[model samples]
Target chain A: MSSVTTTPVPRPATVARPTGRTAPVLRQLLLLALAVVVVAPFAWMVTTSLKDYADVYRPPYLWPQEFHVGNYGRAWDAAPFAGYYVNSLIMTGGILVGHVMLDTLAAYAFARLRFPLRNTLFLVLVATMLVPQFVTVLPAYDLVIRLGWYDSYAALIVPRMADVFGIVVLRAFMASIPAELDDAARLDGAGPWRSLWSVTLPLCRPALATVGMFSFLYAWNDFLWPLLVTSDDTHRTIQLGLSTFSSKYGTYPELLMAGTVTAAVPALVIFLFLQRAFIRGVASTGLK
Target chain B: MLAPTLVVIGVFVVYPIVGTGYLSLTSWDGFSEIKKWVGLGNYTRLFRDPAFLNSLWVTVLYGAGVCVAGVVSGLGIAVLLNGAFRGRGVYRAVFFLPVVTSSIAAATVWRYVFGDTGVLDAVLRFLHLPAPNWLGDPSLALVSLVLLTAWKSLGLNVVLYLTALQTLPADVYEAAAVDGASRWQQLRRITVPLLAPMTFFVVIEGLITSFQSFDLVYALTGGGPLGGTETLGFLTYREAFRLSHFGYGAAVAYTAFALVLGVTLIQWRLGGRERWSS
Candidate 1:
């Protein structure tokens, strides 16, 4: 069950294909054109961020005549961004840690444990995937409010800590792991928890990393729930901070662009580092 | 061991969903002391409400536009990037960058681009083309939102399709070519058929994500320009949080949920069988 090797397809014969040399040149040009389209908005974003207000409104300066490096400082000072950053970091970190620990434990139980009603419960957990988060916003909001967790990190971080998708992915990966590992641990007088901690978790690193990356990205970029839960500036995430920038400084396109760039940097960094896993995660969802 | 998961799911996911269904039938104004049962009243009102109907239409349109555009362009770009090429990795990285960027940030940048005096408008002016106010105009607001969503989501789709393309068995294509199949025929017969599962996956995921489009519209249009861009999700957000109409908002949300669920179920029933066969 652990390994199902797929037969590799034989590579095509190395018959020297005589294509017009211009074909490669043309393909290069076309690919570059595609890349330009893809990168233009981002380039525009960075360029606009460097532009002053006058340069911003002046026919979309392709390059800033006078690059205002101070725009980053101005954008920082434009809102309680420091507080928002700390709040976002803490919330994302808390949610990531909670998800990795809890979801892994749950996945282990679902995949390896022969508990009563396990399949039924796992089915129910998968069914939860069909219900979009929007359906529960009101009740969740009510829960937060009733628990007096509104405008707090508890509201922001706690409910999403146990994600169904994380459990599903982890369970899928865990199901491939041989039960002999757990059995050996049990034979060594290890408890279920000990077997899980010592034997199972170590082997589930790839799945765990995928789950962790996704959880981090989700928590980092989550907007509506945070916006709905936390109204106070002190508890606002970076998204809320950027939105505030938009509303307060609606006229300063350059500053807003700078703030947007600032807000995006962390996610960009994560994507750059864990790109392969991130791409795999995205493709695994079959959302291509 | 499974008890923790069962409890959490039951408490968080199942309970809230059931609670939402119950709330949708109540006259709870979100801050009220007395909760009166209003069986189906919220649903009935939702049908009659012009705002709800319009938002529903907007959501459908947005979903369709994004699905069609994102999937097609994603596949096209993926196919283009499939061949061994110089700097392919960089192009892949650039294409997938939007997936990594925060949606709000992407929307903000797009909002600037779509601004009346922004780069897009300037370009149009340079080309002597008509430049409509994208988010500011009622007619183009939803269209602009759809465009932004497609742009932002295209990267993920590209990566997914690219992965699918690269993983295709080369022998299948070689056999097709041996049978005097042209490139177009090979792509149509072999590639597309083999990619059916990936395509279905893209459609379902695209539908889900497109339906839940909040951040882009929220950041760029705020469902503005006479609520032209107001999706059901946005409407629910406005009603529940902004207007404090919790019961009605819950009903709207449930309505959207039901629609998404119904569509997903249909896709599953239709596509899942085909996937198994393939």
Candidate 2:
């Protein structure tokens, strides 16, 4: 049981020995159930969002009677959602830009450059991923206060701008780039930065897209860090803004659903657009 | 090139971790001009306090529930999907939907579903069955949370498993069949063993994500129903933010961090040494 099965050759699941007709039926049935478990709550969310406040608890119809489109408007007006959207956009956008620029440079250097203490530094950063964010939550807040950055955009944007996972993922991706490309550029007299920009960065578009999409989704979805850093309502992200609605009007299922729907739309849209790349990046880069 | 990223990470991540270690040794209310030195006092108090210990137990239980349930169910679903099937893309997409949705949003939706006589009950009623109040029951709330966590996070595991399953060679299984191996024998001997890497990958990633994650639980239960679902992460947030017991809170947070760290290191050693020996 402890042995590692090093199956280096390709295996296309030859065990597909025909288990007869019943197996396929059973498998499809199980798959349908699993799909429902994953999807039914989301469908319920949309249904509840449209239901009248009274209809939410009555029978849970698949479709609301009137399909109240006004709930979105009411949910929006219930909190400082417009301000939250702006703050979230700025916070996520700023963090994504910072992460892509910084992590790319750092990863390129870690993968390609000859630098002193490089392995030690890279290991230190990677090890931090195992360190729970809460361990640093209080001290990070103290640092924010010391810098007079409490409740400011910088507090939310700066501390998490350099992520361990980003550097690791980008480094793994960049490690695949042919060294000959760099040598070719250097022979033509391009400096390191020029070579990186002209020769290396173009090949890293897939990695960049993956990293950018992940960073954007993470910063947008984050609740705890944003909840800690920004106490000001004006600086609240969508998560904090939705929390306000929850605390005040949580029992109102329709309003909660509406608010959640509004908050999830951006990420859902992003996933719809870049899901293939997202899955490939997540599955491939984390291991080999 | 490395200077900017290194500087930010040092100031933001590395410095704060070191500072937290010192802060955990003292009792400091986040505000005020005084920091009292209470070396080992917080740790000793934390060890004895039943509430903190309970949260620790709850965190472990919750983490275990998530990893085992997520990994097993995810693998089952992935293998099923790997079969020749219609609507594979739609099934895959739907299963992966919750992974990308915001936690608050997912938790919010789940809270409604699990609320008293909520959609889950309605579904059960549609089937003419009894439906327990998942979120309101003390005995069931944590289970409910785990189910929700798995619901939201298991898609990533499924995708990983599917990716791994796709790499299996049909020829080996055919050879096993020719050698008179039954389907169960092949699955037990070959399929299960081969899937170990993906299993470890799923479990490790699941632990990291679910153990550290608080938003879904916080948003859904608020550590509810007699603190039955009170995770250490939630406890730390409440202590530091609501009570402003910054030092005590930091101690609790670091304890949770250390536990995860220890588990991860053990896993690494076990997995690494076993592979080397093999």
Chain A TM-score from candidate 1:
0.90
DockQ of 1: 0.56
Q: Residues A1-288, candidate 2: write the lDDT tens digits.
A: 545576566656644543322346777787777777678888888888898998887663667888899999998888888999999999999999999999989998998899889999998998787787788888888888889998999998988888878888889888988889998999999988999899899999988988898899889998998988788888899988988788898888888888889999999999888877877876676431
- Across A1-288, the per-residue lDDT of candidate 1 in tens digits comes to 545587767775643332322236766788788788777889888888899888777753667888888999999987888899999999999999988888988999888878778888777887788777788778888888899998999888888778888888899898899999889999999998999999999999998998888888888899989988998998999999998888888788888888988899998998899887778777675422
Q: Please give the CA lDDT of all the candidate structures.
A: 0.84, 0.83
Which residues of candidate 1, in runs, are more than 4 Å off?
A: A1-23, A285-288, B274-278
Worst 10 residues of 2 chain A by lDDT: A14-23
RMSD of each: 3.7, 4.5
lDDT of 2 by residue, B1-278 (tens): 88888888898888889888888888998876788999989999998998898888888888888899977888878877776545776677788888889888888888878877677887887899988889888659999999998888777878878888888998999999999999779877888788886676677666776667689878889988888898988998888889999989989988888888787777667563332232
Kindly give the stretch of ten consecutive residues in candidate 1 chain A with the minimal lDDT sum: A14-23
TM-score for predicted model 1 compared with the true structure: 0.93
Interface root mean square deviation per prediction: 3.5, 3.8
